[model samples]
Target chain A: MIEFIPSAFAATFSVSVLLALAAGTFAGIIIGALPGLGTVLGLVMALPFTYVMDPATAIALLLSIYVSSIYGGSISAILINVPGTPQSAASVFDGYPMAQRGDGALALGYATVGSFIGGIFSLIVLVLIAPQLAKFALQFGPIETFALIVFALTTIAWVSSGEMLKGLLSATIGLFLALIGPDAMTGQIRFNFDSLFLSAGLTVIPLLIGFFAVSEILYQAAVLKDVKLPAVTSGGFKLAPWSEWKPRIMVILRSCGIGSFIGVLPGTGATAAVFVSYADAKRRSPNPEDFGKGEPSGLLASEASNNAVSGGAMVPMMALGIPGDGGTVVLMGALTIHNVIPGVRLFSQQPDLVTLIFVLLFLSNILMLFIGGFGANLFSRMLRIPTTLLMPLVFMMSVVGAYAIRSNPVDLFVVVIFGVVGFLLRLNRFPPAPIIIGFVLGAPLEMSLRQGLILTDMNFLAFFASPIALILFCITGLIILNLFGLGNAISKRFRRKETQSNN
Target chain B: MQQKNADMLYGAVLAGMACAMFAHTFSPIYQNEFLFGDVSTVFFPRVLLGIIFVLSMMLVVKGKLSTSDAILTQINVKRVLLTGGATLITVVGVWYLGYLVMMPVGVFLIGLALGYPNLVILGITSLISPLVVWVILAKFAQVSFAPGTLL
Candidate 1:
């Protein structure tokens, strides 16, 4: 790990890689600053472009977008009341008030610096944790692997949305979609129904385009009312004095810790982290009443934590091939397309590539800070482009992307079909991440389970023989029980017993 | 529609899909017994569909007891249908006319359908955007595009 750093630094400083980094960061900021166009859609739109590039350059581009988009959301949140992404929702509370009082530049500055610190802080944590985690995961056998996947899927589905039942159903549907192709073990066609396309199975890139990009276009069409552009009051950056930031150092650091830790958990993402950090900052401040009234601490907490999540979320995906949230899910898809399969094997076989990813992430975050500050005015102007014109371009890109993957006309239909399906699912409050993640993990889940079963002579009880598998199964059971409100029921029973004992 | 009724309908559709999937397990392909283990190709799918069916029914029951409105409180049906219809046409057009010719017209109509008032900007964007994307994807990336017989 220590030796890889110099090599990583050399690779990251090359011409093409730097160009990709700069372009990706610039585009990411604009995308993040625009209301309604978000990080997921931006990543989806960029997916087609990566089809031709090398793995390192492609990853650099996507990582830049992922990191900067979160910070870019704060720009719109400060300049206008609208948050560029859901992750920036907490920024509006104090950011807008600051802008309203003619300190928009200062607010933007705090966000930029806080985001930088948080991003760097999370990268350090990732560097320290991911290699060790991957090393530990090398001990997992087939049964343990299968069990871990089950636990990950269950936990993601259960926590990803408000309605646990719907999330589970969505995951089940994804698993069913995966089973549509040929069976990996026996090479027998199960659900093809004699269609050649079904036998060939669905590819990951087209599925991601359909699920995220096409679905977004349909959703915007369904809900978009009038194109009323918000008034941009300020358009540049201004640094606050050291005295102003000196007192809030602890707040920023604590928020980074909260954000990175929460981001490491499956399914929570940056949205929850930002709010939790914001509330923590507010609670700890002596002048708590100033929280929603242009307090620098509030803005710092929101911006810092959300940006920190970018690094935190990548840890699990790199080490275990399990995405922590939606953005990382897309990143995982991009990695798969580039033939950089992220898992324990990735670490063992291709340590250099892993280091390159770590290096790219660090570079992307540092680049995001400079680009975000230097190009604030230009990104602010990007908000003026009507969603009308922007969306048509998005649709065109979606078409080209879906077709570019395999040059198959049939894939276009797949996009439309899944687009409609995704929109319908969204209407019913079903979280889409579980479906995407489930689809990603589906083959491995089936392969490992069958392999473990065959090795153990088809005795299902033998799956529990491994200590790791037993622990994973226990965790999965606990998650399911909590999802069904069983935890609450037992806690209530205990409370009642305690009341009786006190009497 | 009320959210509860919509949820019930959604649940019913999911249950119907589950039933269809469950029926597929009886087919010849899935019925083949495995040599290595008792678990067949259909075992995982059948289990998944069963779980989906059960949860979907639970959703129906819960929807029946609750008084919540649909998740989307307000939807512009006309716009959604128009946008969806226009997109379908674009796909079909791309099939018949190819990407170079069909994309410009498709984009223009979609923008129009989505209420872009300025035809000048919309028309220019529609025409130029496709060309730029084609050049990047086709020229630089070396991706192939279907040249329709008409084109």
Candidate 2:
């Protein structure tokens, strides 16, 4: 792994790769700085172009977008009261106040430096841990693998946006959708209704375009009755004095740790991490009341933790093939498009590629710090691009992406149908992430379960024979219990801790 | 018109769809009874459908208990329907007409339907975007486009 660092750099430093990084990161920041657009939307829009690029170039492009977008969101949070992304919601607590007090430049400085530190720290953790985690995952058998997928599926409840049952229903719908084509076990078609296109099964590209792109267009069109945001003037970076920052170093480090840990939990996204880190920072700060009041520590906690989550969220996706959140789910899809299936198999089959991904991620963050610092004002101007104009361009991209996948006219209908359904689902608070999770994991879960069942001679309880499987089952059971009421009890305890911290 | 109790309506629709899907999974078209696998093809789907059915019922109950958010808040339904109709026309246009002829027109119509006030910008963009995409993806990258029979 140490030796490959140089080789990884070699692969990543090529003209094409660097160009991709520059383009993706720049566009990502602009998208993130815009109020309505976000990291996920940026990623979804970029997916169309990856159909033509190589694996390394594609990953480089997507990783650049993923890392920089979190940082970009803070720019808006500081310059204006709005958080460009959900991950930046905590940043608004202090970021806006700093801006309100005419210290917006200083706030941006803290966020930039803090984000840089958080990104690098998480990368270090990723480099140290991902290979080992993947190695451990390779030891799992069919039953254990199935149990792990079940655990991963249960994580849908975590990022369900406060609607767990609706999330489960969406996942179930995804499973049903995945079952539409021919049976993998047997070569028989199931739910095609005699259509040639359905017989081939729903392609990932069209489904994603529908779910993320076209649906977003419809939703925005429906809901955007008026545009009301005022343009903000971005100021240059201004760091706090050393003595002022000395006390907050521990807050930054601890928040990174918190961010990384929470990010590794599937479906517990950066939004959650920022909140947890903010609460933790407030708890430890000597001047707790300074939080949400232009406090440097508050900005550091939010920016550091959210940026840290970019690396941490990739852990499970890279090591175990389970997406930790919506963004990684799309990345996983991108990998599949490039013929790089992300799992334990990826590490063994293509270690060089994996190393290159790590190297690219590191470079992306380093570039983000400089590019983001230099381009802050330019990114702020992105907010002026109206949704009216932006939505139309995105629609064009979606059409091309869907059509380019198979050049089938029927796929356009697929995009439209799913787009409509996805819009309705969003309105009902059934989050889209769970549906993608269910779709991505559907085949593996079914295959593993069926194989395990065959191996156990149809005895269901025999799946628990493996210690790994047993442990996973126990964890799943506990999660179910938590879903009922235990989670609320735990959250109440945390709330009490937060209240004490505020005092 | 205002959509009152949108959550309850959504729940009821979801339950109906789930029931329909559940029933469909049992249809003769999906049967794999003679297969030798431990689980039939229908087995997993049936389980998923059943879960969806139960969850939708739960959603209905939840919808009844809780006040619904503004799922349809100030949304111009007429605009939505028109845009949807325009999208359908775009798909059909691309199917019946070739990419070169239909794509720009489709894009322009879509932009117009979405209430873009500047027809000049919408028309210019509609024309330019498809051509640019075609040149980049189809011309440069060797991606094939759907050339309708009319072409």
Candidate 3:
């Protein structure tokens, strides 16, 4: 890892890193301020623009947005009960309560600081760990890479909202949906008909936007037309003093460290990290009673860890070609479209650009302090923005973002279909992220595993032979047990109370 | 829907998916190519189909909807429209307007849907977001995209 200073590289950003970060941070905040507009959706929306820019700038912008959006989400969660992004779900545990008690300013202040701390920690991790991971990744082959992907996918069930069966079912749905286009192995196409677009397979970005963004909007519009915005005292300023923050520093760091580590795991995103950290903090605290009753530490822990996930997710993506989440999936796709290949070689091949990106992520997270600092106040003001003016604009951006992915109307239709599927599933308690997991992994999982299977002469059960595979299997098994009612006893044994609200 | 009916519907979806697999499996195109003593590429999907079929059956009998109706009620229509509209926008935007214009437009629309109205805020959001995308995707990453006719 290079002991690089982001400030030293600011002058070099004329190559587009500065512009990317500026633009990315701006969009990230807006997306985060709005409830349910996720970073994946935001990045997918931005995919088209990358076609015209430099890869470093493109990555910087994307990374910056990814980082800032994670933090921006707390604005809504803290000021209003609704989490702007799912990762901020834990933020509401205390964030909203604080607001309810007319401490909205205090909550935002603590959350902003916590998020800044978390983001910085994760970026530092990216600097320290990413290169090491890249070094280790060089030792991997198709077998190791495949094992890693499997491990990531298995985490879906573990990190899923509730019910491993549903999570597994959700993963199954994603895997199948992925099969709808081409046969990756042969030159032949499998699911496509005469439609010209079918030969290329469904674009993942449009699918993500539809399922996560458009579908979410449709569901919200259909039901929450008159969402009750919580009472607010215009929370745009910092309410907590330095002294109040001093005590929570350790808690924030611990949360960020935990969050960053989990974020690197893929599937286990910031939301899960936040909830887990909050629970851990609460359990370890002498003042456990302070938690869930508008305690600053709980919110601090939640924000710190979730923000940290931004950096953590990048480790695997940079080291291996495996993108850790939907956001990185889009980033990889965008880069591929730009001809920027990832893997162990990317660092050595494009050290300047890659290093530039590392520094940009660092700068973006640190800059987030300023962006998030003032952004918190401005976002709090957004609660008063009339939806009459609000929703149409959101619809507009999603529509535009969808179009950029492939410039295909068919993709738009897919988005709508996925949106409907997402809505129905949400009603049925089906999480949309799994659909993405399915789509993202769909072709790769089938094609790769099939190749591995064929190479092993249909041993079929070769999946279980490897040590890594066994560990992944265990994780999947644990997730299944946890996601289902099967692990309730074990979980109860592990903890005294189940006060950790499921996000 | 009642638990019984929901379970039935889920089972049907799984069953249909399984049938789709069987069609692919038994078809001459696949079965005729019996590579490696009748074990070939179709095995993976076939295995998947079998697993899905089993899972579906389990749902038909032992499966529970898990979520209470009250929770379902909260997921409502606006969320659906928002997600649907965003998808429609992204898919259609790329097809019609240039990618340059479409990126900002998508951001604005998503921002709008989530309840941000001030044109200035929306404009800043729309413009800035695309530029970032353009720089990363176009400039740094070295990938190409669908630039609209206007550009």
Question: Individual DockQ of the candidates?
Answer: 0.70, 0.57, 0.29
Best by DockQ: 1
TM-score of each: 0.97, 0.92, 0.81
lDDT of 3 by residue, A19-110 (tens): 67887897887777677566876776666556566666777778878888888788888776778888898998888888788888788888
Tens digit per residue, CA lDDT, model 2, A196-231: 888988877788778888788788878877654455
TM-score of 2: 0.92
- Model 2 per-residue lDDT at A75: 87
Ranking by DockQ: 1, 2, 3
**In model 3, where do residues sit more than 4 Å from their true spots?**
A1-12, A96-106, A225-231, A239-241, A292-294, A341-353, A386-389, A461-465, A474-503, B31-39, B64-71, B74-151
**Model 2 residue B102 lDDT?**
82
Q: What proportion of the true contacts does each candidate reproduce? A: 0.66, 0.58, 0.35
Interface RMSD, per-candidate values to 1 decimal: 1.4, 2.1, 5.0
Model 1 whole-model lDDT (C-alpha atoms)? 0.86
List model 3 lDDT by residue over B1-151, tens digit each.
5655566577778778787875776555554454444345466567667767876776666445435433225444464566456646665666667567676767666656655536696778678766765676567655455665444
Preferred candidate (DockQ higher): 1 or 3: 1
Score residue A402 of candidate 1 by CA lDDT.
86
For candidate 1, the share of real interface contacts preserved is 0.66
